[model samples]
Target: MTEHLYQPILDHFKNARILCVGDIMLDRFVYGSVDRVSPEAPVPVFHIKRDLLALGGAGNVVRNLASLGANVFFSSVIGQDESGRMLESLIGAEKTVRSRFLVDEHRHTTTKTRFIAQGQQMMRADQEQTHALTSVQESDLFSALKNEVESVDVVILSDYGKGVLTPNLIQDIIKHASELKKPVIIDPKGRHYEIYNGCTLLTPNHKELAQATGYPTTSDEEVSKAASILLERVSVQHLLVTRGAQGMALFSRDEGPVFIPSKALDVFDVSGAGDTVISVFAAALACNANLEVAAHLSNIAAGIVVAKVGTAVVKVSEIMDAIHRDMGEDTKETHLLTWDQARDKVMLWHQKGLKVGFTNGCFDVLHPGHLKLLNEAKSQCDRLVVAVNTDRSVSALKGPARPIHSEQDRSVMLSAFDCVDIVVAFDQDTPFELIQHLRPDVLVKGSDYTVDTVVGAKEVMGWGGSVYLVDLKQGYSTTSIVAKISSGSRN
Candidate 1:
C-alpha cells in the first residue's frame, strides 16, 4: 500500500475532537557536558549548557493529539505550585487544546527532572505523590468529564499510576463515554486492570501485561492466553500490548489476534512512546477508524516517537512522510521523485550536516546481492540515495531482453528496502547528471568497479567527497540468476 491510501484517514484526523483525562505532569531536562570529577565529591561535574521543559504523563497525550491536528479537551489535576502554574501556562499556549485542570492545595505538582549529557541521561530525580485524589477533587474532575463527555468523539484515560485516574473517576468516565457511544481508550497503569473495566480498549506494555495477568508474557502464546484471561476479568473489549522491539499485538473477542511489527529503525529515547500510542489510537478512533486501522496507525506513530530524544509528538506531516518512506510505490508521488523534489531533499539533508551516499543500479530482478549492496552503502552514510536506470536506459545498455521488471516495479522494489532511503530513476544509461545534481557526500559502487572506472567518482572526488567500493557477495549476481532461470538449471 502507498501513502496515498492513508490520505483519507489523515484528513479525518483534522476533524476529530478528543477528550484526554488522566495524570498530568511537567518534565524538565537539563543538558550539559560531563567534564571531570568534582573536587568536593566523587561525582562527575557537569557543565550546564541548556534546559528544556515539556509536558509529561497525560499532558503528553494532549500534546501528541494537538500536534496531530486534533481538537483536544484535556482534564487533569495539579497542585497550586509553581510547577503547576508552569504546566497550566504551557497547556494554555496550545491553541488546539483546551485545559480543564482541578487544583489541589494539599499536594505538590509532579515533576520529573533529568540531567542529560551528550544526548544521554546521566541521572533523574522525581517528585510526586501517588495517593488518590481528594473527595472534592474527584467530584470536580468528574463534573468536568460529564460536561465534556457529550461533546467529544472519544475519551482517553491516560493513567500513569498518578492520583488523577482514581477508581471512581475511571468508572464514571467509562460509563459516561459508553452512554454517549464514544469509545474510551485507556493507557493502563498498575497491576490490576479491573479498575479500567468497561473501557473499550486497554494499552499495556509487555511488563505491565505480565503483572496484570500474572502470566509469563515472554512469547506470543503466553501473551495470547494471558490477554484472554484479562479480557474475561476486565470489561474491556480489546487489549493492545506494546512490546518494546517486537512491536504491538491487538486482541479482541470477536477477531483473532492481529500483530503489527515495530516500524522504528533507530530508537533514541522511549520516554513518552506510550503517550504517543494512546493519543494516536484515540484520535484514530475519533475519526471512526476500525480497530485494526487504529492499531496500525498508532503503531506507526509510536515507531516515529521512539526514534526521538525525549517526550515528543508526531505531527501529521511526519506521519505522512513515515508512511511514504515505508510503503510508497514507484509513482511520481512516492520515492520515485522528480528532480526538484530530489534537490530539495538533498539540500535539507545538507543543511542538517548529514552525510549522503549515492549508488546507481538497474536492479532488474532484486536478489540478495542487491540487498547486500544497499545495506553496505547505507552503513557508510546517514542517508543513501539509489539511482535506478529507467527501462529504456536499461534496455539500451543490457539489451531488450534485460530488465524483466519495468522501471516502476524496480524502483518500488528498491524503495521497499529499509537500507535505501530514496529512489530516483534516471533516463540516461548512467546516473551522471543525477549524481552531479545531488552532489552526495559519498559515492558508492560494487567492488567489480575500481575507483577510476566508477561513474561520477571523479566529480564527487573533485567536490571533496570519496568513492566507496563495497565487496560483492561471492556466487551471487543478478545476471547469473537471470541466466540460471532462463536455462532451467537447479543450482
Candidate 2:
C-alpha cells in the first residue's frame, strides 16, 4: 500500500474513548553487566544495577492505548498489596487513562521481573495468583463493567488468563458490548477461545493458535487450517494470528485470509508484542478502520514492539515510519526540509562530529556559477545545507516574474545534486535567523561578496565557525540565460 493508505486511520486515533478490561500487571527489568559466576550456584549471578518498570499484560494494552492518544477507561483485578498500589500509581500517572481496580485481599498481584545483561535476558522471576476471581470480586468487576460498557467507543479484553476474565463474565461483557454496538477485541490467553466468541476480533499468536485449536500451526497451510477451525468454532467475525518471523495472517468469515509480512528490523523480546497488536488493532477499529486496514497497522505495530528489549510500546510515528519503509516510500526524503527540520538535521550532524555548511540563493535556474559555489561550499564541510528562498520570499527579493521555477521545483533540483546534502526553504528576506538557529560549521558565499558584507558572516564567526568565499564561474547566470531566451538569441 502507498504511504497515504493509513493516514486517515492514524488521524482518527486522537481523542478516541476506549474501554480496556484485562489482567494488568507491573513488569520490572533489572539491567546490569555480568562478568563472573556466583559462588552459590553454577549459573551466573545477575548483578542488580538499575531497574526499569512499566505496565504489562492488560496494563500494557492500556499503556499502548494511552500512548497512542486514546482516553482509556481501564479496569482490572489486583491484590490489596504493595505491588497493587504501585500498579495503581502507574495507572494513575497516565493522564489519559481512568482506572478502576477491584481488590481481592487474599490474592497476590501478578508481577514479572526480568534480569538482563548486555542485551541478553538472564532470568525471569514472577509473583502472582492465577486462580479465578471469587464471587464478591467478580461482582465488583461486573459493577465496574456495567458503568463503563455502554459509554466507550470500543472495548478491549486483554486476557493474560490471570483470573480477571471469567467465562460467565466474558460472555456477559460481550453481550453488553454487542448490545451497545461497541467492537470488542481480545488478546486472548490460555486454551479457551470459546469465552471470547462474540468479540469483533481475536488476536492469537502462532503458538497460541496452535494450542487453542490443537493443530500444528508451523506452515502456511497448517496456520490457515487452524485459523479456520478456530474461527468456525468460536463464531467470531474475524481472527488475526500473529506469526513472529512469518508475519501475520488475517482470517475473515467473508474473506478467507490475507497475510502481511513482518516489518521488524530485529527481534529482541516478544513479551508484550501481543498487547501492542491488540491495542493498535482495537484502536484502529474503534476509529472506524476496516478489518484489513486494522490488521495491517496492528501487524506493523507488533513488528516494532518485538524489536525492543522488553515488554514495549510502539509510537504512532514509529508505526508510520514502518509503513512508509515497508511500502518502499521515503517519508523524510531528507533532501528537502523545513526550518525546524534544518535545525534538527544540523543538530544530528553535530552530534556525529560532522562539519555542516550553509549557503542561500533563489536557485531559480541551474547554472555553472551556482554549481561552482555549492561545490566549494560542500568541499569545506562534511554536510552542505542549501537554503532556497520560498516562492513568496523569492518574489520579494528577485521580483515576481524572476524566479521562473516554483520553490518545490527549485528545492527538488538542488537536492538532486551530489554536493547538496540538505535543502531547506526560508520565507524571510535573509537567512540570518536560520544560520543562528543552525549554527553551522561553515558559511559559504560567492567571491563577489566579502566576509564583512555577507549576511550571517559575523554570527558564524562569533560561533567559532569559519566563512568561505568561493570563486564564482563567470559569464554563467540565470539572468543571462533568461535574457538570451527573451531575445531569441543563440551563442
Candidate 3:
C-alpha cells in the first residue's frame, strides 16, 4: 500500500468510536533463562529474569483498538478477585476507553501465564471459568449492549468462549446492532458459528475455521474450500481466516477469495496477534476503509507484533515504518535485516562464492572516521553487515543522554550509505551472539581493538574466517562532536 493511501486510512482511527463486547482476561509473561539440569529431576533449571503483565482475550482487543487511537466502549465480565482489580487498573489506564464490567461473584477471572526463555515459549498455564453466563448476567450484558451499540461507529464481539457471550445474547446483540445500521466484527471462539448470524465480518484462524466447518485447511485450496463451506452453511456475511505464516484469506458470498501473503520476517511470539488483526480491521472498516485495505493494514500490524518478544501492542508509528519499508522505498539498495534474515542472506552469498563481512558499534554519530572504517571494510568483502547496538545497550555503555538518534534513525542513517549492505540491531552489550549466528567470512573492526580484544574474533577464526583491522582517521570522533555541540561550537 502506498503512503498516501495508507496515511489517510490510519488518520481515520483518531475519530472512530468502537464498541467491543465479550470476554476479558489477564495475560502474564514470565521471562527467564534455563542453564543447567536440576539435580532432583532432568528438567532444566529456570532463573527468573523478570515478569510482564498485559490484558488478554477480549481485553487485548480493547487495548489494540485504543492503541490505534480509537475511543472504545468495552463491556465484559470479570471475577471479583485480585486479578480482576489488576485488569480494571489496566483498562482504566487507557486514555480513550470507557468500560462497563459486571463482576461475576461465582467465577474467578481468567488468566494465562506463560514462561519464556531464549526468545521462545517454554510453557503455559491457564486459569478460567468457561461455563455459559447465568441468566441475570446475560440479561445485564444485553442491556449494556443496547445502551452503547447505537452511538458507536463499529461494534466488535471478541469471544474467548468464557461465558460472557452466551448464545441468546449473541443473537440479540447482532440483531439489534444490525437494526441500528452499525457494522459488527467478531473474533470468534469455539465451533458454533451459527449464532453469529448477521455480523458484518468474522475473523477466525485457519484451525478455528476448519474446526467450525469440519473441512481441511492445511493448504490455500483447502482453506478456501472450508471458508466457502462455512459461508454457505451459515448466515455470516463474510469470513477472514488468518493462516499464520501463510498470511490471510478473505472470502465473501459475491466475490472470489483474496489471499495476502504473510508479511512477518522474524516471528518471536504470536500471542495476541489475533487481537491486533481484528482491532485494525474493525477500526479501518469504521473509518470507511474497504475490506482489502483493512486486511492489508491488519496483516502489516500482525507482522510487527509477532516480531516482538511478548504480547505487545502495535503503535501507529511502527505501522507507518513497516509500510515505508514494505514499499521498497527504504533506500536505493537497503533493507533492514534481522539476525535470521541476515543469516539467510549470508547463506545465499556463500552459495554464490561471495565473502560476507561484519562490523559492530553503537554508531551514535557518524563522522569522517566512521566513513573511513566502513569504506575500508567494504573494500575487502562482497557484502558488509553493520551490527548496531540498540538504544538500551547504548544507554548501558554510554550515558542515557547520549545517542542523539533512536535505533531506527541510526539504522536508516547507516543504511543510506552505499557501503552498508545489511544493517541489524542487537540489544546485548556485544554483538557476539549475532556474529556467532551469522558467521560472516570477514570480521572488520577499527584499529582501537586488537585481534585479542575483538568480541567475535576467535569464533570467526575458528570457522576459517579472518579479522581485518582498519586504520581509524585521526582527530575525529563521536565524543568530540558531542562535546563541541555541548560547548556551543560548530567549527
The TM-score obtained by model 2 is: 0.67
- Model 2: residues >4 Å from true position, as ranges? 37-43, 333-491
Report the C-alpha lDDT of model 3 over 400-481, residue by residue, as the tens digit.
8977888888899999999999899999989999988887878999999999999999988776679999998999988889
lDDT score of residue 339 within candidate 1: 58
lDDT of 2 by residue, 296-339 (tens): 89888988878664566777877887887877776775456766
Poorest 10 consecutive residues of model 1 by lDDT? Answer: 326-335
Model 1: per-residue lDDT, tens digit, 1-491? 44555677788888999998989999987755687999999999987644557899999999899888999999998988999999999999888998888888877899999887654668999988778987777888899769898999999989998788999889988998888898988999888888988989999998899999899887888888889999989888999999888889999988899978899988867878988998888888887778888888889988888876567778877677778778754323555876545654664555344778999989998888888899999999999999999888988988889889988888788888988888888998688999887788799999999999999998887766789999998888778888999999989
The per-residue C-alpha lDDT of model 1 at residue 427 equals 94
Q: Local error of candidate 3 at 474, Å?
A: 19
For lDDT, the strongest prediction is 3
Pairs in steric clash, model 2: none
Predicted model with the maximum TM-score: 3
Off by over 4 Å in 3: 35-45, 118-120, 331-491
Q: Going through the candidates in order, what is the number of backbone clashes in each?
A: 0, 0, 0
Pairs that clash in candidate 1: none
